[model samples]
Target: MLEESIRPDNLALVIVLQACGILAGKEVPVNEKGEKTMALEIGRALHYDLRTFMLEFDNFVCTALLNLYGKCGAMIEAENVFMSFVSLDVVSWSAMLSAYVDQNCGEKALLLYRQMLQEGLQVDAVTSVVVLQACSALAESERTLVIARNTRKTAALEIGRAVHADAYKKQFAYDLAVGNTIINMYGNCGVLSEAEHVFGVLNIRNIVTWNAMIAAYAEQGEDEQALMLFKEMHKHCITADEVTLIFALKASCSMGCLDVCHCLYFDIICAGRETSSLSASLIHAYGRCASLKDATSFLNELSEFHLGSWNACITSYAGEGDCTSSLFLLEEMKLMGIKPDGLTFISVISACSHTGIVVEGAECFMSMSCAFRIVPEGKHYGSIVDLFARAGDFSRVNSLLKSMPMPSDESVWLCLLGACHTHYNVELAKYAFDHALMVQPKHAAAYVALSNVYAYAGIQDAICGPKGTN
Candidate 1:
């Protein structure tokens, strides 16, 4: 009705609404009174035609459309709309580049950034930050690393410093977000001292700054310093959330700090974020400390048990050499309709090996493929072979070897060979050794096992070839 009347103000309002429709990823819902006001207001801005629909829209409207497309991974649509513009400015370029980088097309982002530079477009802070991220992403490939390292060496931190330096030639060292990026860049580059120096001088510190430092320390296995900094974080009233706690728990687990992990577990529970993975970590910590009862009780108390939680408890029991409990848990998992994954099966097989439950282990191995359709990996096969070999079922072990659809791994062959040597089966030991050697040509362990077999049988001289009869 408004378009037929040729009302310029009403038509502008419709154009605005249409742009918003594409921006918000929805069609505009109808409203009357508000439409009239918007129509009158947008009339003061640009006019639009069919091809100029996106481009002639207000900057805010156009940018929002680009953002929506970028965020949703409609890169082609985004590019089409971006290139449709008769005039391309910095914000327009940044929007498109951010989309490319965010969607993991970092190399393309870099190419566009170079094009932007060749056009003498003035890059602003947000644009520089996006390019910095692309630099970090590009660091994984050596060829890409050279490009990123050179770009970062020029643009990221030094630009921040230079921009500040140009103010009466006085360099201001601290811009919170920029400083944090520099800290991150330095930390990622393994220049920890420089990162620490930058971090110490920063006037404002956010969780990102702290997280960067903590991750840097954690990656280096500096658990003590990471924990100390974590304490400092709490003192500074920076509440450590899930990401913080997960990394701390990993450090605690690595350092065998069961008491610390236990305390964190209660803290997590009190915070009302009892995620299964967190609970699993607690079980792992307790299990590592040989506290099987505590691990079992913790698992039982949880309202829902996931695969990780179950695997943690099973592995704990197996590690403690209590295969019966591990087997019991495996059965319970099945009864609960939780089919065993590869890790779960391996944990149970380990338990059986420790406790000499040969028959049960064999049944579990068969069930892995037949019932679950989970093909046994080399590690799983090795564990089962070890179980049977340890139980002195040489015939069963030989049959398993012959029946394996996949080639036997070196570890599997080694397990069988070790068992043969232990049971004084010389012929079987020789066969196992040969197979192991076939799998791993430079297997010094196999050579040692074979020499011992000959020595034990008082045929060492023949094997060593009475070659000078040394």
Candidate 2:
């Protein structure tokens, strides 16, 4: 139409810009590259035409361009267009704030929000929602850092609370989206009580609200409360989504409540919501409950296999001490062209350790780094140490310990101590015990293991004998 010299009206150009924005907002799949290539091209072309037609300065057109740039991950361009506007509106502020949030630039979004308020711009529900989301994201990021450092600081909690206060002050508390986000922010900050309080006072409770509360409980190890909430959600006749089922199943798994898990599994199957994720959770739940037969049946009945389901089934068998089944599943997974990840090898190696399959365990451990290119973490090394300790191969165990890139942790030393106790090697047992103590000074189990070693050596006099008795 442009080539034919047909001058499109402002509404038609705005529609074209809106279409570009929509295209830019689509999620890109992992396996595909250049997913946004076409969207960016079209957006640029339309933007140029709007400028050429002298429509770029129009507030509506500029806002649309800002939205188009924001959605396309062109925040610099979005900000430029936003600043060029002689008049700023809530929509323009919201578009920029959302772009920052979408790109995970929570700090920038918060700063922009402050600027927006300082300018005395009127805030709308959408603006409030985006700002709250930014606060939530920032709180979550801080919480992650605190958790990583093993600190109990309430910085994230404070920030979230402040955002909650602002939401109420701005009268956005009753907005369902804003309310849900506040609940989620509290949940993410590990303040489950606050999350529950928000949930209790909400005039409207959606599935997301309930799921956030349940997930908060589940994540904090309050599985019983989570399960109870699940029940309450059912009583209210609110349908559970995939997320709700996943969290509920997690709670059931933690409690080892096979009955509850079975009921949930039945509901999922009945509703035909047995997606890969829910299937994986159900398999794990059944496995944790020692209902391996049911877990296996569920795995077999699935028309498609998920890597997670395979890992869960393998882990379940390994936990049951059924090393044969675990290994068989590993072979089957390979035959089905499913690449095994670190967890798969970990489970297989653990199964081998439980069954004293030394050769197979050693091969799997080696294959983890060789074939799979997976760098073994501490848990993998611990498993191998346990394997060698079980087989009374002290020399190989010592060799492996020396070759380990990282320091030996309490579990590795404890495994060695246990092996020493089994073989009645008093000197080695004392060495292992001392190492364990060095790693963790207050390891009561290490002290007990050392005492047992002395008892087994018929050296009862060590503790009760006269002082300085060598």
State, as a TM-score between 0 and 1, how close model 1 is to the true structure: 0.61
lDDT against the true structure, each candidate: 0.71, 0.82
List the pairs of residues colliding in candidate 2. none
lDDT for each residue of candidate 2 in 42-102, tens digit (9 for 90 to 100): 8888888988899988888888887777777776777788889887888878888987887
TM-score to native of every candidate shown: 0.61, 0.71
Q: Which residue pairs does candidate 1 place in steric collision?
A: none
Pick by lDDT: which candidate is best? 2
lDDT of 1 by residue, 136-232 (tens): 4454234433555666444444433333333213333365665666666555555577678878988899888888777667656877777778889
For model 1, the superposed segments whose C-alpha errors exceed 4 Å read: 1-203, 407-410, 413-470
Error (Å) of candidate 1 at residue 58 is 18
